[model samples]
Target: MPALPRARLLVAATAAAVGLGLATPAHAAPETIVREEARTAEVVAEAMALAEQLAERQQTLAVLNRRADARDRALIGYRAVLSRYGYDGDPDTARAVLPLASYDLSAGFGLTGPLWEAEHGGQDFSAYAGEPLVAVADGVVTEVADAGPYGLRTILTLSDGTEVWYCHQTDATVVVGQEVAIADVIGSVGSTGNSTGPHLHLEVRPAAGDPVDPMDWMRAQGLDP
Candidate 1:
C-alpha cells in the first residue's frame, strides 16, 4: 500500500467508530433504557432496607428468648420449695416440714417453768447451741427482733397467714420482709431471753388467733416433734 492511501483508510475507520457510538437501535429508545436503570436502582435499595429490618427483628427475638429462660428457672425453684412441703403439686393439701434437722423435746408446750407466765406457749427442742434453726414452711420473715422472754427471736409468716416464732437463737440469719423457703435456715439455737438451757423455742399462731401448741401443729405437719 502507498502512504497517502493508508492514511485515508485509517481516517475512514475512526469516523465509522464514532458514528457507531452515536447510533441508536431502531426499537430501543434512550429514555426507556434510563428509566429501566432507575427502576433497577430503586429495587436494590428496597431489598437492602428489607434485609436490615429482618436483622433487627432477629435481635429482638434473641432478647425475648433470654428473658423467657430466666422466668422458667425461677418457676422451677418455686415449685421445688412447694414440693418439699409435701404438696403434690396441689395447693389445697400442702403439708409442712420440720423446723430443725433433728431434735429432742426438752420441755413440753404446757410445761410450767420459772419463765412461764400462764403456761409454756411453745415447745422447747433440746438442741446444742449453734444448731441451725430453719423455717418450717415457705414463709416471709416478719420480725427479727428480741421479745421479752424469747431472746433473739424471728417470726416467719406462712403462706396460710400463720405466724411461726423461732426463739432463743444464738444468731438470726434472716431479716424482716425476706422470703424463706421450706427448711431454709433462719437462725441458730441458743439459750436466749428467759430460757433455761440451749434449745429452740418454737411457737405457731394463726392469723387471727393466739399461740397454739407447737407439738400439735408439728403432728399435723406429719412430724413427730
Candidate 2:
C-alpha cells in the first residue's frame, strides 16, 4: 500500500473504532450520537483554549528571562568598572583637601621595610572600615578600580597635572572621566590591598613625577590629612 493512503486508512479505522466502540453503544440512537458529537466538540475546544493559555505563559516567562539576563550583564559591567582605572578627558582646575574627615596617621610616606619593597609611597590614615574616602581636589577621575598592594583605589588628576592616589578603598562611587570637587565622597576606607588594618593610603605626584609626601603636599595646599 502507498504510505499516505495507508496512514489515512489507519486514521479512519481508529476514528471509527473510537466513535462506534469507545464512544457509542451498539444500539445508540441518531439523537444520542448528535449530542455526543456536540460534547466532543466542546472538549476539543477546551483543550485548544488550555493550549493557548500554556503558550502565553511560556512567552511571558521568555520575556522575564531576557530581562533577568540584561540585569545581570549590567551588574557585571558596573563591577568591572569598579575594579580598574582608565583615562577619561583632560583634568580640571581643582584644589586639594584632606582625604579623610578625621583620622590618626598610621604611617607616613617614605617608611622603609623589607616588606615595603622600596619606601612607602603614600600616607596611611587609620580609620574604621566604611569610613568615607573623599577626593582631595576637583579634577577628573583618571582611574577607579582594584590595584596591586593598594587594594581598591582611585586616582584623580588635578588641573595642574598633579595626580592623587587614594588607596585601600572598599568601594568607589565614581567612574573614570568623572569630575569631582574637593571632599567629594569618592570611596570608603578599607584594608583591601597589602594592608595590616583599615586605612586610607594617599599619594601625591606633582606633574606625574615620583610619589611625594602627601602630608607635606596637603600642607602646601593648606589641608591636613
Residue pairs with clashing backbones, model 2: 83-145, 83-146, 84-145, 151-193
Cα lDDT, all candidates: 0.67, 0.66
Off by over 4 Å in 2: 1-94
> Model 1 RMSD to the real structure?
34.4
Q: Score candidate 1 by lDDT.
A: 0.67
TM-score, candidate 2, is: 0.57
Model 1, residue 52: distance off in Å is 70
Q: Tell me the spans in candidate 1 whose CA falls farther than 4 Å from its real position.
A: 1-94
- Over 90-121, each residue of candidate 2 has an lDDT whose tens digit, in order, gives 22423455676558888888999875878999
